[model samples]
Target chain A: MHSALRFIALDWGSTRLRAYCCELTPQQELVLLAQASGPGVVKIVGTFSDVLQQVIAPFVKQYGELPIFMAGQISSSIGWFETPYLNCPVTPQAILHSVCERISGQQSLYIMSGLRYQNPSGDNDTMRGEELQLLGLLRRYPQYLHGQHLVCLPGTHCKWVLLDNGYVSWFKSAITGELFDVLLQHSILLPKPATLYTDDWATFTAGCQRALTFPNESIVHALFSVRTKQLFDAYTASNARSYLSGLLIGADVGSILHDTKVESLPTGSIILIGSGALQQAYATALTQANQQSVLITEQEVVLAGFAAVANQTLLPLSCQA
Target chain B: MHSALRFIALDWGSTRLRAYCCELTPQQELVLLAQASGPGVVKIVGTFSDVLQQVIAPFVKQYGELPIFMAGQISSSIGWFETPYLNCPVTPQAILHSVCERISGQQSLYIMSGLRYQNPSGDNDTMRGEELQLLGLLRRYPQYLHGQHLVCLPGTHCKWVLLDNGYVSWFKSAITGELFDVLLQHSILLPKPATLYTDDWATFTAGCQRALTFPNESIVHALFSVRTKQLFDAYTASNARSYLSGLLIGADVGSILHDTKVESLPTGSIILIGSGALQQAYATALTQANQQSVLITEQEVVLAGFAAVANQTLLPLSCQA
Candidate 1:
């Protein structure tokens, strides 16, 4: 195997595509060399291949014939190719083994399969990209393999995955981020904050407290309160954003705790795999709920998962299953 | 007093203004003579007088000095002239007593004051136009004067008002319509339904059922499932809109039933003051929850309320208080 640069790690999402030039070390470590991002699946309304070619042109010029390993929305129905979602409870191997491959000239592109989780209630939920991140986290840290651990991957469709002894036991998705985005752009109730205004964390925490303190009125009525608070001068335009964020995150966490099938899941601190402001908001919200969380950088886990797929480390688990 | 026509009854809200030329009968009952509507307070960024003059031009020509009784957002800060909000638990008399008036030519325009409700939890909520509608309904139906009745004015901002002995005891607002509107226009998850397609009431009832059945995952997560159902072919693009509407309305009703202070409040059938399809949707949702409801036209209540204000019939209650 060529050791210097073996694979291209790509996290193609609905609205954006992120790529990283990666190498495999002698000690079986994935090293990220160069990174690039551009228009996501949503932007490429025409041909996915053409957009992919344009987006990864720089990486291809630097390292030729390096097979691309991809995950996320790129593998779903709307992406470059449609791959079947593997049903849970699935191990890392089940994910790696289900990769669908396509060839562009001499380059080999492998897309990781998505996951379909059926909760105890028999309702099914799907995730495309975050599954790979979970696999990568498991490969890097095997401590989570013994006991049942829960991970909250917060985003546009935040995923709450329950990992039990190296298997994805069950998962649920919260549409908080997407709802928040639409509300921010469209709702007449919430005023548009100034460009220079930073998030008011105190207001956010207060919102989180409200969510925890008042569970019944948390989702529906509390959202309206964002507007009422602004109208009543209790919250300024700048602080409304943070307050909205806190309310959403707090409600999601509260739902996961109260509503889900596995309410009594023996997980201590939730493993939150996300980055930037959104993740921090969730972490703060969890803290307000008296719940502890450990944050993991999204990119690191995604790249590692792609590396794990490339090296076929997950094959043995699938074979065992 | 002139018996033929006394005043123009204006129900000015955030997005639209509905006006009715009303007359006081020999028995002191209100009779709506003619009606007109135009862009609401939100659309009138210019001088409200210009828009008002344009809309009621025909009425103005006929009834030269007939007074105009206005209620709703017209009396808000952003409306023609701001009126102070009356404190709850308040009778229709208090609302009438707080009317702010302005003289346009020989015409006296009276704008009804809003209502402010502060709960035991110390959270404050306000209502403008719905308060007038409630007062109008109370004037028309005196049965509510002796018992605790619940009135739901379903609209962009759905007002769930609790009326106890002719006073607005406690009320809550849900931004369901506004959320649904934004999601329809802005969110990528839901595909636009066919314009010519009629509403699938069965699918809507199914959505309501889902909301009632899945109480835990109903509000936040169920919204996202509208997208997944379409993606997985569980629901088509045509039915997605109805399903989304059901989910929103169902969750809203569920939230009201579960979370509010009047969770234990006993009432046979809710008094739903609304019109058209939105009212039908709420009624269907309420029926799904095994709750009965009585429908009342919003216009009748508003006009009656305005006439009551103009004739000073509500003064007796204020004097008694």
Candidate 2:
């Protein structure tokens, strides 16, 4: 069992820290043995080392001093140690070579470097944790490594990564999630009595269709439609909430489709990485835009990412079998 | 003096109320006798009548029960009287004829109707207060009454009204100002310590240029660039704030330019109604978009709007001279 154990993976972000005790089978498949979570870097009351120990205590107690791999904001400027972002057109091997290893007491901890891309237009965009997921995607589906693909990871700041022949060529980021949150909480677009959002796919699809219909219009206009629709169309608070989500997600998807000329690309070439409601919304939006997309759960990708990195850097030669 | 005095014009909105005491000269010119302001409809603690009486006390005491004409949120469903919106393509005469009158004790009050437009695509947009301003524009510059014109009113909700041959053809409202306020106050893009915004024209121009360059991309993506520029390019909080304003304003202007094909229209055909920093920012954005605009102050337009409506509805035939 100890021989089967590989490394502990930590997905630490702004709000939460998720720890996965991972193992590699003889067939080289990654498996999650145990998992734990706690407050993220921003929410930590005590020292990061102390919080880290507390979070991984049970796993450490079971498997003594396994190598720990950390991703996300854990390597941000405010994290335990700041790691430099690797410039884009980066490959998985290039990312593996750039890992910053630190000795924390008796534990060997490795922090993954993020990716930064400066487009031909000289606009700069940076992502910390999603690089590992992209790398994991490459590992899981080597077929993607040989082709040009658009990989979308939806979150607070949704990222659209362009992969060209095994390299991360460039990417764009959208503030869709954060804008939706701020608008829902602070703007007049928010319905009174703050209705909790429920799944209303029809309303959501309508919003997506509205956004798609006006591909050239600023989203600020569509956002105001959320208010006008409620006033003139008798949209309830729940319907408005669902519709708002769809408008934002649809705009995000539509921007990529318009900017990248996704209609000209082969169908199902766009890969979406997210889970649950956001994934469903993006899928619906893509469908509304007449674009096909392949969906992958975020958890699957992140764990596979950690395992792929661990296999390259931590797993012994004997484990290669 | 009382004989020369005309109706009092109230420009009451969500935040504040301003009352303009006016007189029509024998030469048919509108003269401002005095002006006063107080909390708007949303901030009124007491009855609308009490607030109105208090705000217009000096004028009423001086002139002895002059007819009062009110516009803005004061006539909305949430305001003192729920005045229905006049549908487009409506004329100023139609608006005056639709005025809803309510007698408050000894005082007679007339509430001006708002405008609601449904485009050919069946999208709805509504505007209060600005309808009067649009009427004022026609009154102040009768030349605008004969041709196609785009009138922009930049405020919390920026309004774009299309006037065709003396009728308010249709209009579109962008939540640009409200979005900037909400984003600056609540989003991750907000610079720390909450920097007070000052004039940073260079930074603002950069943002406008960026937005105009990406006319096909969603503003959501450009919004994320605000954070990225701060992270990678070392932008100050003030710079970020100014840049954000430009981005929103630019996107708003770009949408109209693209949608209306403004380049095909006569130059300087767009009339901008606003004042202060917002007016300057919008002017700059319009200039950046290569579209010329004529400027009008909010005070001038609202007063003219109220005076125009009053001249039609409240002024007796004896005062027509």
Candidate 3:
């Protein structure tokens, strides 16, 4: 039987810290054992070593001197050490150099490198923890990404990446969800529903279509139509929520997808990495914009991604040789 | 001089107020005398009579038992009382009924009626003070309204109205200026400019074009480009300001006039209202959207509108009969 071995991985983001313990069976099935998390490395102010020691103390107490892998903002400019942003066209070796080094530790540790790419416009894009998930998803479903694929990782600034040949070729970020919050709460035409998202969400979906179809239509006007329609007794406040939702989603999709050659992207084949409201909103937009669909949850992808990075750490001959 | 004018017509809106003192000179100029505004009728709160008593007391003291002509939100539902929304396809008589009979003490008051029209799809539209202004502008520049004239009233919600046959037909409002404020301040794009609008604001005008030309582009993506462009040394703060300005104004124009086929409204002619910032912004949009242009300030046209409404209050014997 192949050696029953354990692996551990850590993900530290702008606002989170997580550590997990896992093992690969002789049959190569990955199983999670224990996991722990604390406030992110960036959020806590202290010596980098102290942060690392404090966070790992719980796991260390149970499993002494374990192999561990780390990724995320802990490797950013203000984190443990300034791991300078890796420029485009970086290799695995170059990426290794981009990881944080020099920590006085008693056990084994491997740091994952962020991915970077240069666009034809000489622009650059990079990612760390989430990129690992893409690799894992690709490894598991290789054929799904062989052709140019559109992968959307939705969040604060939702990143939409186009993967060509297993590498991130180009990507754009849209603050669609963020803007929705502002427009809904802060803007003048805030159509705050007396109620939350209701059953008649189709009105919102239709508003999205209006926005998408007519990129130049006055969203303000469309927005006030929610009020006037309600006032004039043609629409209800319940409908207001959907109208506002549709307007925002429609506007976002219309504006973003307008420049793209819409026919080129295969419908219903999108890869989405998001959770909660953002995922649903993006899915709605994708359905509207491409008449196709993409729905990939961030939680699932993030865990799988952490595992994939851990899988790389097992090849010690490459990193420590 | 004859009776030295027993009354003045006060037309108050989002910005300034116009008081058309109704008296006669050898050459009738409907002399517009004094104007002092603490707050508009829509802005002040209290009993309708108290607000009117306090606001008009000063003006009433100056002109004594002066007949007053009122309109706009003064007749709105939340105002003194419910001057029910007459809706669109409204006639001059419908407006008189929409006004409160006792708007100003015992003095007879007549509030001008706004224009309301329902589109073929049953979509409704209305305008407040602009109708009177259009009435006056047409009275003065009749030909201007007949041959495809587009009048723009810049405010919190900018209105673009198309006038023909001495009637205010259809209008659309754009929240361009307000969007600029939110996008510039609250958005993740950039902090508000250290200063107010610059004297040379070509950048803002250019922004309008971008909005008009690329209405369907993801505003969030467009926003990121602003920062990235700034970071990569491609855009200066001025350019950033310009891009934002262009974006909003462009969006306004794009929303109002993109491929929209109405029955031949002249592109070059535009009427602008509001104070300086709005004036400049309107000028910029007109220049870009029309390629050829002329801007008629609200000051010039609004007074004419006030005068027109004042003259109409006399009521020809033919109508009374």
Candidate 4:
């Protein structure tokens, strides 16, 4: 067998699960061997063990008895195995150390721990798989390790993390994506047979501007505009959908800009971790909020994160073996 | 037939349909003859006409062929018939004039038009049944007819209306109730088998304070605290629900307090129109925002509105007859 360290990395969230077969090179480089996906933790029909077994079967056949590192909702109570949440100001090493391990069949599985943050007012906030992404970001861009930085992970529960000198200090989570989905599907904002959202940048920008203009007002009041604009024939259903997206993303980004703590930070470009349409949408919103943003794909960060974990744990073990 | 002018008043909304057999006396008194309710326009299984017939069967048996004055979602496109929305700075008489008339079977049905308001920024807002509530409030409290007053009708789409000398000068709709329901039922904030929301005023008040404290922030950020508090064992599932309610209601009221236009108005006790728990909740939130609120039942205001319509349209025709 080759001396290179090998392991499987899993990004299992609420709706989707992705498994990456990875190898750590001699020169401390991480390369993806193969990747596969299945239903997420929530979408799994059978037992989690059964779903995990099936998802990792192909990877196991090629690389027998490899250690598997799982992230995302797969570490929550409803996930495969519940893991502890490490309190912030947490480090990537602290997160790796807190990982819960169990042997499933013949494979060693490690579930990553999430981070919990308490604001000054004593309100608690949390994130799971995204911590790995933040860690990956830190690994990729070491410059952030010595300075204060802001990283936003936009997803079902969009997260805004404060990275201070390499520690995940404090973070806030916004239910932007979930709220948009719920409002479009369930609230009166959308017409019957939900309108398919198109990439109408003009309409989206207008929504962002509206949200930014009323930075102090609750979005609940502004959301009705979605329905009203459609009712008045001022917006197409598709445009309305896009506008709703813009409103939510705008509000999310706007709040961060309006945040006194965030405002106090050195006006640095926010590190946005995500890809495709959502990332673009957030970037547009951040620009509207007059904040600069740097984009990093989810795949890149998650891979870098798993590689960090692999280098810390598997490399040493493989060398010893 | 009796000389008194008689009509059937309908408060048909999305979830429930209410019909009042009403008589306008010679002395201009509105008397409730009888009342019945059925599934709302959206809940009707077969047809709208069929549902209306079933809901008003008893009222019809007692009052004979009376003109039906319908308000609420019954005037929307999805209702029995779509009525035009009167432009804002609208009065009760203006709304009555725009009523769309149709004969369903043997009943003379008059579906009241909703009111549409366009703010200075050209954003449009429309309200259907709540306009009747506002008109009713105007009739019940004529003092509001000559001065600036803010009237809040809290419901699924809570309406914050500005009345300038009895004209509904402008208004805003916040999806507070709808958002609360949707988030509790569909969002990750709640656990599976959804937490039953109970009235825990202390926890609720805490939530209200939090929202009011950060009046400028989007609630999407605050909402995740509901899950975190529960996860941390700091809040029970029930208390979390109450806190969620407080946050939404606080945000709604906070926006009004923070609104420059609303702030410029002479200080007066805001008139609150609704009944039961929602009204009480809003009153509490208003109090938390340090604003005084005067309460009126929804039934009283809606009935008054229908009476105003009957006095304007039905009484004159009956006198001629």
Q: Which candidate number has the best lDDT?
A: 4
Would you estimate the TM-scores of all the predictions? Answer: 0.90, 0.87, 0.74, 0.95
Which digits, one per residue and each the tens of the lDDT, describe model 2 over residues B213-233?
A: 889888888897887778788
Interface RMSD of each: 1.8, 1.3, 3.8, 1.0
lDDT of each: 0.79, 0.83, 0.59, 0.86
State the TM-score for model 3.
0.74
Q: How many angstroms is residue A17 displaced in model 3 relative to the true structure, after the best TM-score fit?
A: 10
lDDT of 4 by residue, A1-321 (tens): 436788899999977899999988877688898899999776789888888788889888988867889999888866777888899999867976766777777767887888999888788888989999988888888888988999999998999999999999989999999898888888767776844557799989999999988886679899999998888857887889889998999999988888887988997899999999999999999988888999989999899988888777776676677
- Fraction of native contacts (fnat) of each candidate: 0.53, 0.88, 0.41, 0.89
Sliding window of 10 residues with minimal summed lDDT for model 1 chain B: B312-321
User: Which segments of model 3 are wrong by more than 4 Å?
Assistant: A1-141, A191-199, A213-221, A261-268, A288-290, A306-321, B1-113, B192-202, B212-220, B234-239, B263-268, B271-275, B314-321
Which residue pairs in candidate 1 collide?
B16-B40
* TM accuracy, model 4: 0.95
RMSD of 3: 6.3
For candidate 1, give the lDDT. 0.79
Candidate 3 residue A235 Cα shift, in angstroms, is: 3.3
lDDT of 3 by residue, B8-87 (tens): 56665533344554553324456655554545543455565664555556666776666677655455443443344455
The digit string of per-residue lDDT tens for model 2 on A1-321 reads 325547899999766799999897757788888999999776699899999999999998998778899998788755788899999888878976777888888777899998899888788888888898888888788899887888999887889988888999888889888888888887777654566767788889888888888888888777878877788888877788888898888888888888754445555657999999888889889888877789988898898888777777765544564
* Worst-scoring 10-residue span by lDDT in model 3 chain A: A89-98
Model 2 vs truth, CA RMSD? 4.1
Candidate 4 interface RMSD (Å): 1.0
Ranking by TM-score: 4, 1, 2, 3
State in Å the error of residue B305, model 4. 1.1
**Which residue ranges in model 4 land beyond 4 Å of their true spot?**
A61-65, A103-107, B42-44, B61-65, B319-321
| Candidate number with greatest DockQ | 4
